[model samples]
Target chain A: MTRLITILIATTLLAACSTQPTEPDTTLYNRLGGQAGITTIVDNLLFEIGGNETLIGFFADTDIDRFREKLIEQLCEVSDGPCEYTGDSMAQVHADMDIDNRHFDALVTDLITAMTEAGVPTGAQNDLLARLVPMHDEVIHAEEHLNGDER
Target chain B: MPDRKTRLVTLMLTGLLAGPAFGASKILATSGAGSIEGAAGGGLVPWAVIGGYGSDGEWGAAASLGRVDVDDFRLGTASVLAGVHDRLEVSFAQQTLQVEPLDAVIEQHVYGVKTRVAGHLIYGRLPQLSFGLQHKVNQNPAIATDVLGANSASGTDTYIAASKLYLHALFERDLLLNGTLRYTDANQTGLLGFGNSGGEDPQLVGEASVGLFLNPNWAIGAEYRQKPDRLDAVDEDAWRDVFVAWFPNKRVSVVGAYADLGSIALWDDQQGWYLSVQITN
Candidate 1:
């Protein structure tokens, strides 16, 4: 009886260590207060960054309104909110333009400004930046490839 | 003598070879701080301004070593800086500008100081405004002693500067704008100018640059600078530059720039290639 008890205890301990993480609820719509809330922030960001003269040239041939909607949709989808992401990989899309460090910095500043305008708290901004941090490697490497430059 | 010259050249070459590639990841002005360029003593166009992301802290610092072939001189400096809770920054820098004219290995030394005040314009929805003041101790006993002019320390020469930085995004694009204005005190040193009655005047120097973000970590940009002749008799020309900067992450970056430094004594126009490496924590 004692041996059996010991065996059960061991199994319990093993299970505790190996337990899988609960999957995040993919329906982020409710958590984010639905699409309306997300849309407001996205719209604000687009408007501010779009009117920036230094950054405006990058979108000379692009559509600001459509891009804003897409960004909102993707952000909403990624945060376990109820949504879908249909955009291209971050690298593939930015491969053609010769994006560099300065450009990246400006984008971060714009995003921060947009978030502030949309009332996203600092903690939330940090969380969002953490999630998107991985994309930096891809985007930069893609541009370097275009120029045949390597480090 | 030939061997010594060769060794010096080799040392300089090695320095260039090992220097950072993305410029300094720090600011160059005395008020902004955190740049290797400060060690060189004074700001040099294209060199000082062509930097990666530096506006992070309430303040940053930098140092550099500089040389002017025409004057046959070299200078070194150390600087300090602080940012105002990330909304604004105020900086102060002191430097030792030394010259090594042809025959003299250590010709003369001059002391310099610079101050910068920058703030993010939150009042009425305007962008951030960057301002600066740079001064030098003009009582150059070396220059004065050389010309038998005076025997005491001199007054504080000044330079006033301003700039506006903005970030933008449109559709799949990202952009940045940087505008600058500078007014120098004819008596003070502008960048590397060390002597009295010499160097560029206290006129307005302006800069405008635009960068397009290809992605979150990459970008391309173009820039231009306007210079005024400090001397009443000489005509000084302005310059322009273009560059490509690569950022692998926020912590590291490399930049390659083409610069035109107008004309120097024998070099006609001082145009060359520059590579900068920037590192951040």
Candidate 2:
């Protein structure tokens, strides 16, 4: 029994060890091709979103050029790139959009399609998606959270 | 390690996966495989994920056929599942079990309802949690009640399942962990009927599964199910399976596994292959 327990512990430690990043040269931003690559990805995302009727409505009143710039900055900041996001907070920007999980799913689908079209590898795509997943709560329940803050 | 026969099977599976399109918004394989009991989960254990591709405010359904063949037994099942608003799931399955020695066939029907009570499969602080109940009835109960001295021909099993996904956790691949706590006394999952002949109480058991995503389209996993030891006439061992699943599109998924049922009734070393295909919309 003791030996079994020891083997189990060793396997767990090995699993934990593999999660650590081993590559010093390749940051997530570098894998996405840095500035030029990021621009292409964002552009591809905007094009796909434009064609998606369900998600396109959310951007109806927004200024396209500024939205593009802010999104690029946001992606860069999230990927640990060399840019700082100067736009409004995620919750604040999406506060009145009335977005729900369905819309969120559609948007995520479009983003993945865009990244795939931009030639991002599967590993890099997964890494970026994982980092952005935390913002889901902010995107969907922005009004409720903002109301809570006000209260 | 791609052999010619395996490559042929893979190509055939790829061909079978191409069908008409139906849309569901969730990411690929976020909804787990169709369990034997008709719930969304691994091949043997139920998971917290709701079946189908629907997100909030959306509804979807799935239909599946599964078969398992061991040295001495054969089991076949057909199941259908419905998911409402990404929160509630209702399912039904009919299973047939064939025992080689006795040349006896037992048919059973299962009805299940599962609801996700908290958290999300992805993007949440808490692991995805769900509560579910499965009611089973044996169509051919004469052998169990008359021969095995079982408590009843019908029984209900309740469970709480939790699941979580860790991104880039193992070898730069995503890892999924799930645990299910179940309450039941059904012997051989109700194939031999419910409870022991001497009226032993239902026991709490554990079921768990782990999966590593090789890519967005493919995953490899293993599952273990702990069983009750109530039947004095027969010894029932635990169940285990290692599986590979392919999601060619939102419409279809295929799962193949090597299952070890341990021992069933009088037969020992009950190991076999299991395969299932599901279509969703």
Candidate 3:
């Protein structure tokens, strides 16, 4: 058992060393197929979201065109593409949605589906997801912060 | 007396009836495979996550069947588990060990309960932690008590397990790490009954597993389980396995592995194949 643990530890350390961040400009955006690729990914995401019952209601009142533009911009900005995000903050935009963990997970599933449909490689998909995962609290608890402001 | 099979079928029937009302909420593949002791985990160790797809407010249930074929013996376990509000889990497993030499079988029942104490698997820095207990009853302990001079036909194992998922940790695949510390006196996991020549006191043992999700539907991993040497009749050795698990959807999953059960009773180098399937609501 000790031997097994030692091997696991060694493997983890090796993986950590190998994962030292790659040069930004070359990997993520290129893996995501740059802006054209990002657009395709966003279109596929929209299509996927269109078919999801749990997430459709949230977008019912949204402006599809603007939402598309902002989402593409956000993805591009996060991927460090030569684009600027002109959309509202994640918390500000999602403040009134009453979103929950289940909802967020559903969206994540749809996003994964969208990315998979867009033929994004697993590594790139994971890289992009890592960038976006930190926003979970802001997205789901946006309403709580809004209420806190009121109180 | 209602045999273990009858009890298992009854529980499965009840779960099937009640499952659809409030199940399948969590993301796919989060509810790891079921262990022989009926906890959600790798085949050999219980993980910290509760069984099934229930998230925070939902309920979920699952049933599993597992088998292991070794050089000298064959082992089978059938289990059912329920997850309540994604916090507490209660489970039952019926294990049978077929001793080819003795041309006999030893059957046992394990009732387990685990509660998530703190943290989350994928959310934040803290690994998911849980506390659990498995109360095991050796239905037929003639060989254990009369022949091997075991102390008891029943025992309880308590453990604290922690698990975490590192997203994109290696090769951009998700990696899962689980560790458990258990206090137990059972010999061969109670197939040979509890405590013997080694001592009456339970010993602390360590168990661990590491898995990498190849995708949302498939994962490959390994497990190591330390054992206590309490029986004078034979020396107990640790267990290990290399496994591949497939979670096709929320309803079903399959796990297959190559296992090395070091030694059991008088047998040596008891290496073989292991397979298990779990159906989750």
Candidate 4:
């Protein structure tokens, strides 16, 4: 029993030490190829969305250039880059968009396709998606307040 | 001869394959394949993630059939599982174990339920955590009592599991890690039945899995599951497996593994191949 405890402790310590990255290369922004790469990804994503029939309707009334700028800034900031996002909050921007799960999923799929086309590595794509996932709640139900519905 | 159990499994598979898709969708390969015990995981060990593609406020169901061929034994399993809002899961499985030379067949039924308590696998810092309970009953009690000297023909196992997916974990690949602690008195996962005649207590064991996602749809991993040593008649050892899982689409998945199930029913060094197929909606 004592031997088992000792082994468990040793294993835990080893796992902890192995996963922690040093200060030199811990930020996800650097791994994503910094601001230039992010701009390319965002540009490709907007272009793909613009061509997608199902998603194009959502952006018809919006300013494509301004939206692109805001998205780039948001991605850069969220990935721990030096840029700061000065756009409206996610809830505020999407509050009246009435985006459902299907629309949200379509946009994400387009984004992933764009990233792939931009030569973004799979790991970096997943990391960026992970950071964006937490904003799902704020983005998906922006119209629920007017409908007084709870999901 | 086709039995009632076989017919039920067939019907369940048909239903699962024919069911309409509904609910919020999770990313492909995020919901792992069903374990032999009817929980969502690898071929052998269950992970903390719920089964199927259902996100919050959605419903999903999955069914799988598996076969494991060992040196001296052959095991077949069929299971069906349902997930509610990606928070609670209920599952049922039937296992048939055939012993070589003796040509004896032992059958068991397992019913399981799991609930997600907290956390998310990818979105947050906290690892996904869940609690599960499984009740198992042997169809042939005589074999368990007379041949194996087991105390009971049925038992319950409870477990807590934590799972996490780390993007860019090493060399720019996604890594998935899981840890499980189980409290069980079952002998050979209840194939030999539950408890022991030696008046020993239930054991607490650990299980773990580590996987590398080569892509969004493919994962390669290894799992280790610790078992209890309750029955005095035969020595039981831990189980380990190396597996590859592929998700061609949201509705179909296949997992293949090489398993080392050391010592079962006096048959030592039971190594073999495992295969499973699943359909989900």
Best by DockQ: 2
Candidate 3 or 1, higher lDDT: 3
Give each model a TM-score.
0.44, 0.89, 0.88, 0.81
How much of the real interface does each model capture, measured as fnat?
0.00, 0.48, 0.35, 0.26
Residues B1-281 of candidate 3: C-alpha lDDT, one tens digit per residue: 34658476557856764566465657778888978888999999999999988777678888888899989999888899899877999999988889998788999999999999998787767899999999999999999988887899999999999999888887788889999999999999999999885556699999999998767788878898999888877878999987889998888899998888988988988988899988887
Q: Tell me the lDDT of model 1 at B174.
A: 43
Per residue, candidate 4 scores C-alpha lDDT tens digits across B1-281 of 34688678778788877877875366677778978898998878888988987866677888888999989999898898888877898999999898886888889999999888998676557999999998999998787788778889898999999999887675456789999999998888999988888643578999999877766777777788999977878989999877778888888899987788988978898888899998898
Best by TM-score: 2
lDDT of 1 by residue, A1-151 (tens): 2332353345434434433332366233443346776787677767776776445777888777677767887888766676788876666668877665445545656676676666654434444654554465567567654455434
Candidate number with the higher lDDT (2 or 3) = 3
DockQ for the candidate 1 complex? 0.02
Candidate 2 clash pair list? none
Which ranges of candidate 1 are over 4 A from the true structure? A1-151, B1-81, B88-125, B137-171, B186-201, B232-235
Off by over 4 Å in 4: A1-65, A76-84, A94-110, A117-119, A130-151, B198-200
Residue pairs with backbone overlap in model 3:
B198-B230
Q: Among all windows of ten consecutive residues in candidate 1 chain A, which has the lowest summed lDDT? A: A14-23
Rank order by DockQ, top first?
Answer: 2, 3, 4, 1
Instruction: Report, to 2 decimal places, the DockQ of model 3.
Output: 0.34
Q: How many times do residue backbones clash in model 1?
A: 48
Candidate 3: Cα lDDT at B214? 69
Q: Interface RMSD computed for candidate 4 is what?
A: 6.7
